[model samples]
Target: MADAVIVVALLLVAASATAAVAQREPARQALVLSVLGVVLAVLFTVLQAPDVGLSQLAVGSALTPLLIMLSVRKVRRQARAKDRAR
Candidate 1:
């Protein structure tokens, strides 16, 4: 049973990772990346590493995605400003 849970968690992580990579837009990619992070956390927990899992959940699912979206927003805003200046 434990093995089966681990396998399923691994599969979810793989699938979410693929989905993240397959995304075209930066915002969409970030969202998918967040999902992938959560999936990875689940996999870590399944492997009996709760500490690692919690850190991954906080960093991957939340912090990373938040940072990515902020970066994207800043870049887009700069582009718009540049366009208006031109």
Candidate 2:
């Protein structure tokens, strides 16, 4: 029973990671990466490591995606400005 749940979590993490890698757009990749992070956190929790899970939740699922999205937005704005200046 527990093993099955663990397997499912592992599968979800693997699929999300593969999807993240396959994505071309930064925002899309970030979305998938966030999902991966959440799944990883769940897996950690299932494995009885709530501290690590909480850390992953805060850093990987939240901060990492936020940073990626902001970076993408900034880059896009810079690109638009460059185009405007041209």
Candidate 3:
């Protein structure tokens, strides 16, 4: 039972990571990355590392995606400003 859960979690992590990498847009990629982070947290928990999983969930699922989205928004905003100036 435990082995099966671990294997499933591992597979989910792999699939989500691949999905994240395959995304073309930064926003979409960030969304997929957030999902990947949650999947990774699950994998860590299944591996019996709740401490690591908790931190991963907080950082990967939340902070990383938020930062990426903010960065994308800032860049797009700058590009728009530049276009306006032109």
Q: Name the candidate that leads on lDDT.
A: 3
Name the lDDT of candidate 3: 0.95
- Every candidate's lDDT: 0.95, 0.94, 0.95
Error of 1 at 79 (Å): 0.5
**Model 2 clash tally?**
0
Q: Which runs in model 2 stand beyond 4 Å of their true positions?
A: none
Model 3 spans with C-alpha error above 4 angstroms: none
Over 1-86, each residue of candidate 3 has an lDDT whose tens digit, in order, gives 99999889989998999999999999999999999999999999989999999999999999999999999999999999999999
Q: How accurate is candidate 2 locally (lDDT)?
A: 0.94
TM-score of each: 0.96, 0.96, 0.98
Question: What is the alpha-carbon lDDT for the whole of candidate 1?
Answer: 0.95
Model 1: per-residue Cα lDDT over 1-86, one tens digit each = 99899889988988998899999999999999999999999899889999999999999999999999999999999999999999
**Model 2: per-residue lDDT, tens digit, 1-86?**
99999999989889988999999999999998898889999999999999999999999999999999999999999999999999
Q: After superposition, how far is residue 14 of candidate 3 from its true place, in Å?
A: 0.6
Q: Residue 80 CA error for candidate 2 (Å)?
A: 0.5
Off by over 4 Å in 1: none
